[model samples]
Target chain A: MADDSTSNTPRDHGDKTIEFSGLVCPVPLQDYPNIILGHGGGGKLSADLVQHVFLPAFQNDHLAVLGDSAVFQLAGVQLAGQRLAMSTDSYVVRPLFFPGGSIGDLVVNGTVNDLAMSGATPLYLTAAFILEEGFPIAQLKRIADAMGAAARRAGVAIISGDTKVVERGHGDGCYINTAGVGIVPDGIDIAPNHTRPGDVVILSGTLGDHGMAIMSVREGLEFDAEIRSDSAPLADMVAGIIQVCPDVHTLRDPTRGGLSASLNEIAAASGCGIVIDETRLPIHPTVQSACEILGFDPLLVANEGKLVCMVPAESADAVLNAIRSDKHGSGAAIIGRVVADHPGVVVAKTAIGASRVVVAPIGEQLPRIC
Target chain B: MADDSTSNTPRDHGDKTIEFSGLVCPVPLQDYPNIILGHGGGGKLSADLVQHVFLPAFQNDHLAVLGDSAVFQLAGVQLAGQRLAMSTDSYVVRPLFFPGGSIGDLVVNGTVNDLAMSGATPLYLTAAFILEEGFPIAQLKRIADAMGAAARRAGVAIISGDTKVVERGHGDGCYINTAGVGIVPDGIDIAPNHTRPGDVVILSGTLGDHGMAIMSVREGLEFDAEIRSDSAPLADMVAGIIQVCPDVHTLRDPTRGGLSASLNEIAAASGCGIVIDETRLPIHPTVQSACEILGFDPLLVANEGKLVCMVPAESADAVLNAIRSDKHGSGAAIIGRVVADHPGVVVAKTAIGASRVVVAPIGEQLPRIC
Candidate 1:
């Protein structure tokens, strides 16, 4: 039975010669009581959950092999006006409300950003809610209001949604899962594989603010801290960038595992190496200190509002300038460039001229932030 | 502040002109009483929890306006090998271990049936899971193994997925939500709108078996009669019928609210009328006795492995035979037809020439059974 289960697990890449069953999650659900926090921790637990539960539920020819994203041929079918970019996200933050932004804004912006990353003009969103009993009506009202303001700001339509309540003990105060649909523009070729050597990497503004802010509040740690979540919409910026460079290699919002995970993903997906100078890495001084004090690498922290862009080197300067001109991206920096050899390596050079391999994050730096 | 909050409250479809406003969940984290069953109940309190806690956190343009289902424009982007159909559904039926099948198999086939209703050939699926702390690992393995078998039977793959574990008492044993994407063949236009006068309606199999089975186990009411969940994939059957006749007008699984909700949704979406002869509706004698004893209307009950199809009058024989040829659909029956006038009404003519209206579900008929 166990052998049958293992043989049926979905493959990561399409090649039969190269299988990836070696990377095991620490908290295997198959051996545990139920799911643990580590399941969402993006370590072995997360991987195991995907392999055991999700992969089998949807064993499609296209999805049987996982990729950075699912790709289907868009050959000669009618994909005209209603080209949509749809995405869904579930938010389980420690606190339902947070500094600078609350759950409402996070839900709306999270999905919109996903659409934007797909190079689709994010136009519509759908929010589905599973609420617990006894949650205050006033609090629910607050989230709805925040969602409205965020939608208006993002210039998208809050179109459709669903709401259901689970019994109190069956759920927390709430768990919101959102699915979005956006139209992928015509003549655009934006994909993770589009990354190539000589492509320049851009970081929009400072990092670690959102993750740090949540960490401080949740942990009750005080820093002469004026730090707040860098939570805001980047659709406008994404649109402008895509307008200029419709074929940009990859665009990712460095959210949960911050810059480290995003960069590692690109490196692995494109089968290339990335080189970055620590001096050019953007970090708020306070955030840098917070990371140092907590013994957490700023690169491994989360950022709710920042994006990572990989564009052709010649358009690097133009793209950086354009991003910098935007209020949300004033601190934009040309952080790194893609390289051909030494694939799947993300390297950062220190001020002292030493290079350290910044491996992909094993799991969660801050739990339940997004 | 009150006016803003009121404006932001998540609006229902009862009010089409919606403006989203709501605050984050205001309940204190430390004060949370352990989770309870009511949180999953589809009631006003559940809506409140979602609005205050979940929606605010993840609010986006599309998620604010709650609807039966979100309507999307296909535009020009061709999916799979043709134009497409897409949908999503979450299953949290009680008793992870159930008669005939588990939640895993139900979820896979449920979403597949949804896509096929639009005459879309099942292609890819995305599965997301929320697992409760302390759930039995063996049971989870059982469910996952069942899901893999169902997907193999359905000929689909799960492409993308997410898994999260809520703190103990904050979630049920587990809940599974699936999103399916399928290809709709060209010149094979099927939807609610395709139903015209004289269009023949077909019922794929027995009614109320699934709902009764779940209810029996949930209520702990056993009988001399044997009952099992009629859970099975409909993709093969849909493909088979579509191949013989590309003009299959409508296809729907008689799930949640059973024959009633499916027909009502189609009637409303297509702005047509349906006349179903109650005598022609196939109800297993055991299921009939069970519903009679429980005071449940089979029409308003649920079915996991049943379909209600509408085909041209001339092709009804081919359609019925095509469906009957499948092992899962051996008991298929020609049930009714579509009418041009008296739109949005689904009426059942009884043996005594009396007609009764099938209205939309009035509220929670059976919660968490999906």
Candidate 2:
């Protein structure tokens, strides 16, 4: 089962197909050279690592969807049609506490957002902590309190947990893993593969705030107007949108790899093209300045609280109104649309009226930004 | 919010109550000093850590049950009575591979057995891995293969997963976190609090095999017949027993802290006393010899595949017969009985007809055995 599909073509350009024969090792381990922290940053390198290593090893139908959460039907003994969704993520963001949010809330909101992306009302979460020995008890308490508050605010219960303490030098301060189980409301089927050509893509709010916020603290960058992390739970916002329109095609949170990586993934999964107008893309002024100063692309930076959705053109206005009603989605905008041409490519219309292909970053622009 | 209950009394004797007037720091952080690996060893220290730290922070109704897995009812939109159970564990064993199994199968079986202890059939598991950079892909492949095989054998699916790579020196080769969701059958109310004074305690198989096996390999000890880890899945065996005796009070897989910790925890949770006959306690010759030579108590050594159940004396014979029918429980024995004399105490009746209190270990004899 050595499916060397990735080895044959090291790079994928939208719907275009390229192949090379007579070279068994098109991309060997040597080509990867070594796994950098960027491989875990949820960027192009992260996708490649999962595609080449994890997917082939744990091949399954549920995992094939590559959605933020894996949704399936669990036929109970006494009842049927039990649609449940499960997702897991590990948080290793440096500087446990940041300007607006810490790793604790990030872990809770990250997993919750993943479940909400699948049109599920995030229900229960299980947390696991890997702490290094000598980590202050007071700091652990602060993180736990933050997580508890986040869970309470998001309307999910922290049902069960496990804590493991590693040797002093073997681990960083702490790494948290949160796995969630949510109930996908009946009649709602949202997945990346469901995107269609005439779908209108809507973004919940601004981008690059979360990444730039973390970087400001990590790199000691001071700004007159501080850029705070966009780290908030999106389940209520998603539920609001679904209430207005249940036929939405896909919902994804622009996390580690940001909008570029998320849109590319959706395009590839649906075998369709995505075209967006750069002028409509929402960006806070401070975040824009920070990205420019740091030499980072706003499209490739991470966002913790925003979501990208592709809905039918007919229901786009109603869906946008519903999202705009939420405090977290006040800056919602229709940034893009799906197209039939160019299959899996994402094209951005620049302000000068020229179009550019949006490529996924091969590695993380900021490691451990989460 | 500061529950410093562990500080007052450093040690707990069976059926005794000792109180100190008002020492704010009963067991001050400085008393035990630094955090040791034994604190995560599932012994008294581990229990104390959970009691003084985790419970106070993430306090909720579900976690108070203190069962291997939390059993909760999820009301379905289409149908009702969707009883579900979930549990999470992180594996940080030093060596990835050992005699009977590796960390891969240990994670799978450990989680499955946990769900089984709550009388639930584990259905789905989500795996998250934290890999150290420079770790060999071949080794990861072997672990994944073992995990896939184990999941298949146990009749569970690996639905979704996440992978994160840490810098080389910051992490061990790999640490895995697995959280499972299972379905609890109707009318099955298995819990630690359900235990009664007259309940019969049954040991599924011999004790200390797993811990001894790991110690032998870690210490480079050899024997005529190699002692292997008793790491096997007990879901099927548990199902078998439930079929015959659905009134089982409690089921526990004695890992990390072994029978002593399991029995003590049950006694404390159920607020009852337990009395086990030494003559009836099952112990393999090799394991007994190894424990004796190593100056370790078999009751405090870990066992990955064994189980301890508290059933009514009337149904004890039937449950034993059912467990014996399974290959993993061929050596099942009725080793102990619950008592009403003293609450929250465990007494062992020796061959000489005298009884001695079985105190829980303050720390683990063998750390990271699971």
Candidate 3:
């Protein structure tokens, strides 16, 4: 694990060789040799990277919580007890425009959703753009306009922005990073670690639509029905859930490594087992068909507008009803439950009445899905 | 200005022509025919791009103020009267590592300083990284360590982070975007539009060290003395100044297009004229020599750790004292004063007793100086 490959001399590890001059390696290289796309895929690899690299360097009481967003209080007389949530995500989806949504919409909705997952009322966002030198100004304007529309729909103001242009060919046309700040109302505390053994898992909507939408565009494969990205804001739906059940244990948006990743994270964070019935998952027909064609599993595919919630069994019905009342969460359904046995694991009951462990993907099945 | 170049057919504008397919342009393209390096140089071109593109798209009450950070209040009863500041910046400097500082330090300090500029006590930060595939993980750890150290020095916590990797050749090693949130104490308000006719301009320290440091390393030019980047955090100094002079009108860091750009922005935003004595501008001798050799104007060169402050004449002495007491501002000096004549213009009093208009650079004198 202690791979000292950045020395003046060349060093070989397994099948990979790395060499550099006049630079010292500060942290030990563990597991993977070099950073692969999967390291950013929010799966086992992404988690490993965070555990070994980022967490150690930036460990703090707030970050250690590792919720969708960092929740903290302002330390001033006027702002005492004001809990704020902040989160950031960078969007680098290929084929900037896709069915039902564009990268612009994804960037805004993605960060908003992350903050929403923390049970916060997202208020303002900051956007930064990294554009290729020759990127069309017209396309930029379109993206910006789309972002504006999305922010308006989400009821969040884009209060600050920065733009940088890399030399042509150094970027994929454009990439955007948005950071959002939201307020967590009193009595609403949601985090992965808050999950309890008696919590019921509810999914807000269909899965795989967002991932399949991007995949279809990239692969040029078509089905009888068009699949659109489920890229919509979930803050209102989340607010409704909190209003109905303020003791909601956890909330997660299935993005990047998708449902499996989110479920595994919650299980690990809470030291509880999650059991889901595969047949109960709400997947769109077109998305299911596309996933079949692409050899993808809907369970591991991304969804931008969907969320998974963990609430006490007694409050499950109320939370589900609140979620169903929202347009974005009309398809909400109960899919699973948390258990004390088999802690830090997730199990799926198959249609054939057999049960199997549902493992998080090591990397991304669909790169840049969000 | 309405350049509809995203149509399937080609379109020509003056000497430059642009053509795209299947996309519609939503905003008018003005000034520059295409996105250039200058658009991200933080000079006039950069300002034009924001004025024409970003501002129109993301215009809001908070954003329209155009302070270093957006200052706003939470809408809830618990957080009422609590004003918060948020700012974001992206660092894409070449040769990731340079004398006295690296991109890691810049990423942390840059955002911290921006929040400090708004008279906010820097509190939390979120960082997102876009890394190129095949980049050494060991180097990444080193950068992460540097970021951690810088955050510690700035007295801020990096509470959240996201990482994404582009395929090799699609990125220049790494680019980091950091967004910071800070709490503004009651009765403290700082913004460019608050500048008044009787405000005295004070500079914290010497200029051009950061840009020159990067330039010296990039150009492989060795001078008699090593030019180190003054990439230090200014939050503590700012807090001290605010404590002494709560009514400080404006604060700006001389980053990307440097002092010229910052002064020009204050002049334009406040509708006030600024007159600076060139002889009083504090500049390191080595930096001056480097600028002469590189044909770069010190006024147009970037400084990572310096700040320009605008305060009423009565508070100038106290503010200067507050600044000078801090190590980062030991060389604090009054270089200029705001004037009612020639609003929206900045002038320099040359050593020969003659004055000349100091126009903001049309583009970056030194690209990626930050």
Index of the highest-lDDT prediction: 3
Per-residue lDDT of B94-201 in model 2, one digit per residue for the tens? 678988899988989999999999999999998888887766666777888888888988888888888888877888878999999998987888988778989999
Task: Rate residue A180 of model 1 by lDDT.
Answer: 55
Residue B175 in candidate 1, Cα distance off native in Å: 2.0
Docking class of 3: acceptable
Q: Write the per-residue lDDT of candidate 3 for residues B1-370, one digit (tens) a residue.
A: 2645434222434454221121222332344445777778887767777877788888788888877789988875455466889999988898899999899899999999999999888899998988887777777888888999999988999998898887778888889999999988888889998999989999999999999999999999999999999999999999999888999999999999899999999998988999999999999999999999999999999999999999999999999999999999999999999999888888899999999888777766776666
lDDT for each of the candidates?
0.71, 0.84, 0.87
Which prediction has more favorable lDDT, 2 or 3?
A: 3
Please, what are the lDDT tens digits per residue for candidate 1 over residues A1-370? 3443334232233333321223322321333435566667554456556666555544565444333234444335555533444465677766878778888888788877866787777765555566675565566667777877887788775654445556556777767665555667776656666789999999999989988888877777777766788888888888778767776889888887778888877787688888988899889998888878888888888887889999998888888888888789999999988998578778899989999887666556676778
DockQ, all candidates in order: 0.25, 0.46, 0.48
Backbone clash numbers for all candidates listed: 72, 3, 0
Candidate with better lDDT, 1 vs 3: 3
Evaluate model 3 with DockQ and give the value: 0.48
Evaluated against the true structure, the overall lDDT of model 1 is 0.71
Per-residue lDDT tens digits for candidate 3, residues A149-193, read: 999999999999898888777788899999999988877889998
Docking class of 1: acceptable
> Which candidate, 1 or 3, would have the higher DockQ against the true structure?
3
- Indicate which candidate wins on DockQ: 3
